[model samples]
Target: MNNNNNSICNKSVHKKNVQHPLLINFGENQDGDGFDEFILDTFRFVGGRRYHNVSSSKYFLPNDLPEMDRLEKQHYLFLHIWRNNFSAPVREKIITKRKSSLHMAFEYPSAIFIGVDISPIFPSEQKKPDNATFLQNMLDGLPFEDDTFDFVYQRSLASAISEDQWKNDVIYELHRVTKPDGWIELMEPEFLFSKETDAPNCHKFSRALLGFLATLGINGFISSQLENILTSTKLFKNIHCEERSTPIGQWGGRLGEMMCNDYIESAEACKPALSQFIGISHEKFDSMLENIRMEINQNRLYYKTRRFYAQKA
Candidate 1:
């Protein structure tokens, strides 16, 4: 996919991928947490359809499973298939933007694709195979030469690495692998659960779910702390931050509608597995999904996306 003559890959030969191994960590926790099911269902719902990249304001290839870990790879695979199955507009949106990205990068050409995650399934190797590598170690303790990579990217990592030590490990690893002028970008969303009486999208449920998730060692509240963490570590320079509150179930627009639908389907797909492994009663899980749907339909609860990128000095 890197065959563009853009700024992101100019000096480099026009290749579809680079050799510097995109180290992506997989989250294989199919336990009671229901995360695996959610991921799978997400792919099943919108695997191929083009979605917005809130960061670049552009669309890139959407895969059911990205060329990362097992879970992600599965999703990118779904994405590839979905794209082929989508209507003309969705397909056009994706193709046009990806081409634009290639063009834009030709001018900017600094190495841009790198990913790292703390895998839960086999810590030994990445779930799937790609040009990427899987680290069997903790994120806080990376074993790499100093300044090894151009950029460090992470998303939805909180559930695997709790909040307290999350930032410490993340900062440490990002700092360790990043080149002198590299960037570290992180993306995480909050998990909200409404009270039984209020339904979905109620601030109360959102707060309660957020609080519950926090206690479980997930940093569902990492949105506000990203900038502070970067600043405190002094590991990054020229930090830029952006936040977007996406309504659940695509309530805000086409994208939001997609998001909302994806969440519900993902929740349902994993419900059986979640109940089997996590012991969450089916009733409760269904209730939660229903609540989420209600909120989206009512234009009540939404999620905020916080993205920040900084250069290593």
Candidate 2:
């Protein structure tokens, strides 16, 4: 509350995240090009992380994702575990610090403001996600050297590939590229009834559909077994699994109803895939689905969704 305190900010929060408008907007000379790329190349790298060589060495902080995550975690780690953001000398000053978070507000405004960061941000006609370089290859052959990314995330490929492919190819590729002290996460669904209830049509239909998945060489039970599968590799440490009991009917409320509808829609796509395994006509399968829908509601079913995350040693 001092009279000498800053009043007019530069239409921004932190001085680090904000820049003169000329850098962030177009010059009006012609189509905006080269400026962004040129500015980005100036974000000098100290070791492997990013730093602003444009600034004097007084503010020595790397504005990389790990650093950003740490700053956010530092706030919570102090607040919840240690019980504050540690500006305890004057809590009012701490409040001021919070009110001035350029990154927490603007830095995360869109993943566009992010990079693998844009230096002083940028002026561009197109925004790229994480400045991500999109490349594609078979999961068996991820295009990277050993110990690459700081983190890896994979989801919902349970029905596309065989169990062997999952165990040998996909998981291995992820592990092989992740750095030590890094982390990887896997999310999948077991598609099992949470409890064995008297939903005959629901039970029958699930089995029939799983039989369909079998023909495609998918491990339909992948979600339930993900934790075990990850542990079997023994390549990671501090493995953790979180399970979600997603309700399957209106009785479970809004989220449950949506989950139920999603399952129905997913199942409906099975006819083309399922036709080879099950000899039922399209009309017959359609009728079966109607019964399954009614039975799930009557029986109060729940679906299993599981996520497993672990750190590398």
Candidate 3:
């Protein structure tokens, strides 16, 4: 929030001409390509825009940036640590059976990738590949029909929904849209960390952030309760959960460096809300974030991530 702080709040509205592997844009149809046309049509039919009216501020994170790149990096980081998109065995089934036509149309041999976000961060004019498609949508009420997808997964979306919505709407809708015996997974961070030695400023900022989120009806520790939430739904079976801890700075290697940057970005993204709710100044908030970064670079800090998955029965 500091004047010198990288304008993290500045929204990127212009579409960049640059192309990345993760950018998926399905442009108008060209002649003599029936299959590609069919796929694009299907993607359009299935992807809905029920939440288009919702403001991006409701998401509790900065969505005005090129999040596609951040998501691509985050996806690879998970793959690097877990070696797969999921820990549940149903992931293999979803990959092998090809039961979901929506999943197959985007990718011939590989699993189809479809992303929906409330922000217009993805490309909208370029010709997208068959492997993936991105849409603007909301999590609370997905536009898909009941039992439509083979695997339903939500990651780092804890801040997007309130506690009541998570309990009454988000979980139910995710379960409702998943096919019988399909899988639903949630991966989120607790946003709580520790350092080898006492770092008062960093701890103070972290606590303040957690408290701020709580006022919005978001549980900063929701990741730890994911297993219980899934089990209590009575709509899933074979529930499983896993946790991984990684260093934040040079001590954690290249991956750690990336994670450190991720943490910093998250903090910066939440600055506006923190400032408004906690009455903290932009300069003080920026200083606290810098101190946290310093702790990470000093190899004194580490954080944990939790992943939970279950099968819809």
Weakest 10 consecutive residues, lDDT, candidate 2? 20-29
TM-score of decoy 2: 0.59
lDDT for model 2: 0.50
Candidate achieving higher lDDT, 2 or 3: 3
lDDT of 1 at 25: 20
Q: Per-residue alpha-carbon lDDT of model 1 for 1-313, expressed as tens digits?
A: 1111112222322111111112222232211122354454333233333222223111122322222233433333323323321111222212233222223223334322223222222222333223322332232244445665544555554444456554655566666656676555665555553232355334543454445555556566676787788888877778877655555444457655666665565445444434444456778777767766876667545556555667787
The candidate that wins on lDDT is 3
- Which candidate leads in TM-score? 3
For model 2 the local lDDT of residue 218 reads 67
lDDT of 2 by residue, 197-313 (tens): 487777777787677667656678888777888899988888888766656788978655665665665566555445445787777887877887787777778777566778777
Off by over 4 Å in 3: 1-57, 66-68, 96-112, 195-197
lDDT of 2 at 42: 54
Model 3 lDDT at residue 72: 50
Q: How many residue pairs clash in each candidate?
A: 36, 1, 2
TM-score of each: 0.55, 0.59, 0.74
Ranking by TM-score: 3, 2, 1
